[model samples]
Target: MKNDVFLKKFRQTIARYDLLEIPPAAGLGRGDKILVAVSGGPDSVALLYALLEIKDEFNLRLYVAHLNHKLRGRESDQDQKFVKNLASKLNLKFFSKSIDVKKEARKKKLSLEEAARLVRYRYLENLADRIKAQKIAMGHHADDQAETFLMRLLRGAGGSGLSGIPPKRGKIVRPLIEIKKEEIEKFLKQKGLSYRTDSSNLLPNYFRNKIRLLLLPQIKKNFNPKIVDVLNRASNIISLQQQYVEKNCEEILRLVCKSKRKNKIVLDLKRFIHYDISLKREMIRLCVKELVGDRFASLTTSSTELSFDSIERTLSLIQKEKSGRKVKLIGNTWAEVSGENLAIYSRKEKQYNYPISFPGKKNLRSLGMNIKSKIVSRPSLPQKIKSKGEEVAFLDWEKLKGQFRLRSRRPKDKFKPLGMQGTKSIADFLIDMKVPRYERDEVMLLTTKGKIAWILGHRIGDEFKVTDKTKKVLRIELIQKQK
Candidate 1:
């Protein structure tokens, strides 16, 4: 008789969750490739061996991907070599990359741990795309989930944040999510497998490390010995409740949301104010997430730090019928009440006046854009050129006086909008355009001789509009800065 109880348990877990089976809604099949992230640690080593035991049963192809965050000098290299040898022993194809995580941290203005995580995931996604992998496998386990829950709890997280790390998200799957770290170590020891350990993990330099090395053990020693299990159970219960709430919230959002765009979301106040206060708060959180994109979802370590204060402030603005009232939010986002609609949008940074070099490009640092100006003869212009967007504007070269200045709207600024009878205040123009009051200050204005020529992304001044009598045209293009 075979003695493989651990392997049997692993298989049971996989089957219980249908980890290997392709969901009916998914576009791929069961035989597609899966990418496994191996960090040469005990948890990942156990995960790799367990998956290898069942690879043939599922008819799945396995590829190992490792990222060496070059923070440990020689030790990091040894870890990479260890993982490579392990992959070779298993006869699995391996892909590896090394990145200077400290340098990345400085460049991105993030902590070393955050930079490493971001770089590691980006590399995994790119490799998966290159190899046509259906899913990416991670080694996070129950102990990690417990630690995450405590961290979020200490930070006063709501239901969604208290749910802990998700076992499955998009194309990423955690095969060992329900397994304990001790169980992983037991499996590795039983199989006589060798793995490398990162010394930095022993240090309390990062918040998660502090929780793992200090707080968790103290909690277990002073309180329940099975605190990890208790936390994991609570996470499961909360996750189920959150899922139900989120489903209902999505339906309510669909009914009340007026519009959803790349960086902005609008919801009807009439329909939104009728929901219960609890659902109202959830609705505001979801709208903020939609406006700022999913990346902002993880802006805080707890992953739900979109503080109650911000949401309450926004709700108050909506209740007061203050059309132009707004409240700033985390992750450079804001919520404003505008004419029976709640608008959530990203805030643009303030910009100062900068003189534009004729026939040259000038960087708009605050807006993440560049202005390119060029003068060309009227005869050289395309005859049937369609407007690309409001970002690009053409003006009569002769109508311009001295060098143009790019700046924000002044208090007494006035502009002659194209096809308009007379000049109008910039404030009134923005109000008519429905631009949120808080964002109006960041709108770029191209002025020449103290006269408004173009409202960057909206309209061109009537005096600068190109006409048949124009001898030459000055073309100005606003190009977004690529990351």
Candidate 2:
């Protein structure tokens, strides 16, 4: 029968992808639950019917989940009622919820499309967790994948984005990913099943809708007649290649990066620079993802989804800039060069400023270091008075005027070095010291009433140096905090 042909192809796809058994190794067995997301559309309705036809063969438990995004008023409500009635007719359990997508969009400062998607997925994830479902199935056919690929391509997305929607992501599975939308409609019509159509989908307000209603049809008519098929095939090939590269990236990430602290990941500059540019881009992307995992998931355009420009800016900081340099990233994240390590971390709200306390320990929270200052007699000082390490500074206590403050370098700042004859601009001093331009702003200055007395981690001011005439000595030591 014509009906039999459609069922046969559906079964073949399910078997090929091993969708019945989530892990494939965990063979389709008894008591297995699958949450089917029914959006009251042709694609989803067809998916539900196909699964129902073969549910007994796999001994599967099927449940329908729907979200009423209150965008179309009465039409949206009707969609929910339709899906509920359909589920009841099949004697299956149905779960549904209503949400004001417009309000959510305004509150989150996101577009209507993005807000709806975020709220929809969050609801499904929670429902799946509550029911302990093994998999959440969605109806995203090959046409959707092609549309997504083209959309991302137009936006200048890289290989990962070009791969289109994945077949499986965590517990979410798309059994219809390889099927065409036309085939789904044909199957629904053959089965005499009626479904609700969302009027919003016909609107050209959204980029995806425009692609689906206008761009795709034009491409098929004017360009390749089988544009969807060609795009889907390309996506499949790119998906496999992306998986391979991502696996290698994970291995390289383990070898080159370490979890330095909460909200921070450090990559070894030495190893990172050796990698090819393609690998470097992926590595940076992975780092950003790791740094902001799940935090921006509700946002439609995730900050983790770095654009080509953002990745290039980050790579410039890593490859070209010197140690102590940093660049800001999306999602309130940033990448910094700390010595031979590159740190990717979330931004902190705390300002990096603290006054130095004499004869006591003052914790510099921003720098993750402690300033220990002690006023002691000259004899008590170390005989060597080793000025080799910048962390330790021996200054004449009497020479210091007013209060000492630790702050970042300011514009046109001038400081007289301990050995230099005259005062030199901080900019010139950093250049002379071979400090990277990007890192110059981060250089800390120990100031006495706004006069630079010491360039922390670098040189000390000549005016503040302890001479033979000095009776009292100020021993300032910079101690790194223990992890």
RMSD in angstroms, all models? 7.2, 8.1
Residue-wise C-alpha lDDT for candidate 1, range 1-483, written one tens digit per residue: 132766776776677666777444433445648899999999888888888877766767899999999999999999999999989988999999999999998987778767787788788878998998988889989999998998888877788788888777666778788888887888888778889988998999888999999999998999988999999999999999998998999999999988765556778999999999889888888877766553543455532258777888988887778888888776678888988788887765544788776777877665668888899888888764344227888888899979778887788889888878999998898889887775586677888998888998888898888777888988989886532
Location of the lowest summed lDDT over 10 successive residues in candidate 1? 295-304
Per-residue lDDT, model 2, residue 238, is 93
Q: Per-residue lDDT tens digits of candidate 2, residues 1-483?
A: 777877887777777776766333334447459999999999889989989887777778999999999999999999999999999999999999999999998987778877888888889989999999988889989999998898889888888788788777767778888888888888888889999898988999889999999999999999899999999999989989998999999999888985554456778888888999999989987777766665433332533356788778777877676666667766677777866778777765444455776888887665767788889998876665669328888888898969878887767789788888988998998888977544455578888977888888788998888877888988888876533
Which residue segments of model 2 deviate by more than 4 Å?
22-28, 260-262, 292-304, 322-332, 347-483
Model 2 — TM-score against the truth? 0.70
Worst 10 residues of 2 by lDDT: 295-304
Question: What is residue 233's positional error in candidate 2, in angstroms?
Answer: 0.5
CA lDDT, every model vs. true structure = 0.81, 0.81
